[model samples]
Target: MFARDTDDFSPSERERIVKTAVSPRPVAWVGTRDAAGTDNLAPFSSYTYVGADEPSVLFTASRRDGDLKDTPRNAIDTEVFSVSVATADVLETVDHTAADPGPEEGDEFDLAGVERAECDRIDAPYVADAPIAMECTLHDRQEIHGRTMLIGDVVRFHVADEATRDGQVDSREITTIGRLGGPYYTHTDPVEFERRY
Candidate 1:
């Protein structure tokens, strides 16, 4: 057995340890609108549903050198966002959203070759390919200890007909993707995970 205090490691090193340790994290294909009203989409594995009782979701964004990225920046301005589930059917294109030529390049949705569907309750849009989508308005955020956590109130829900059976989501009908340790990802089926950075 081997163990060491993580406090001795650098931020990147700590992240590596933590990320690898947490297996099968849910991914959210987040959508936001920029200051120019241009649509922006990105996939984040660091996300989770706070609850639907009050209907909310929380996702994290990283900042460097005091600069906020497209997602968080637009989220701060518009105070709204959309979350589209990254299912197996559109997982490839969902990963494509991670590409970074630059924010000024163009809309990631168009770049990734996905259709944008209007959200019902929020000011944002969602990936049309998603089986389930949530329109959310920014509820609150916690900015502390060099981390920014974005929390949203889910105001509306969208369910593709095929994804639901008898008013309940049928998982067998829609295989969703999940993020594993590194560059590795997993589908609904069991697989021997590979390391990715």
Candidate 2:
């Protein structure tokens, strides 16, 4: 057996361990609108579905080199954001948006070649061809050690017609890409099993 105190590792090493040991995490292609009405696209693996009954999710946006990023900043200004599920279908393009382009130069959608569709309940837009998209409003935000935790309440969800059965989404229909350690990723495939609980 082996053991280690997380404090023994440097910050970057701990990040690597967490991202790898977490097994898989959903990639949220977040959408926000800039002050000039330009749309910004950014994919975040540091995200998770937060609430079941209320339809909510949370994503962490951390300052890079002491500079705040636009996605969370836009959400702060507009009080709304959109989430487009990042599936294998858009993996390459989604990965392209992960590169930071210095908030002032260009739109990520243009650089990534991903088209955007207007969100139903929010001013922001989501990836047009995503299997699932959510329009969310900023429910709360907390600053913890310079990271902005954006909690959103989903106001509207757009699911592909073929991806649902009996009002429940068929997760198998859309194979999502999960972030792992640098330059690595994983896929999500559903397996059926009866639950004892």
Candidate 3:
């Protein structure tokens, strides 16, 4: 095992270590509606799983980079957003959305050629092709280490029929893509292993 204190490393070095150590983070292809009602879409790998026992919730962290990224700002303004699961089929489009354009630039949906559909409960839109999507209302917002932590309460879930079975999701069926270090990505093909009880 190897580890180093973050204080001893430069920001870029720390980022590299963090991104690599986090191992295959699920990519959130999030969508939100701007003040002008235009649909904005982007992908973030800094997402975490919120437990099922509690209220249905998911966490996504975004930077307050001068309100340039539409997702965070729009969620703050409208109190709503959508989180869509990214898969290998849409990986290219997802990558395209991660590109940092100017604040005044048009929505990434147009640039990525991804179709968007209205979220049932929220004013924003969601990716039509995502195997699963959650319409979320803002639960809380806080600043953590210069990033905005947007905790959303899941209002509605849109899951593809093929991915759902016996009232649960089949991970193998969904085949979600995950982000790795640099430009690497991984698919959710399960590997069975016995857990020590």
Report the number of the highest-TM-score candidate. 2
What TM-score does structure 1 among the candidates reach? 0.89
Tens-digit lDDT track of model 3 for 29-99: 88998788877888888887565655455555555544535678888899998999998887888999977
Candidate 3 lowest-lDDT run of ten? 59-68
Clash number for each model: 2, 0, 0
- What overall lDDT goes with each candidate model? 0.85, 0.89, 0.82
Question: Judged by lDDT, which candidate is best?
Answer: 2
In candidate 1, list every pair of residues with a backbone clash: 182-196, 183-196
Q: After superposition, how far is residue 79 of candidate 3 from its true place, in Å?
A: 0.6
Task: State candidate 2's TM-score.
Answer: 0.92
Q: Check candidate 2 and list the clashing pairs.
A: none
Local accuracy of candidate 2 as per-residue lDDT tens digits, 1-197: 76899899999989888888885888999999978897899999889989979899999988978877889999999999999999887788988998876556578988788888998777998999888899999999999978999999999989987677777898867788998876698888778988999
Q: TM-score for each prediction?
A: 0.89, 0.92, 0.88
Q: Of the candidates numbered 1 and 2, which has the greater lDDT value? A: 2
Q: Output the better candidate (2/3) by lDDT.
A: 2
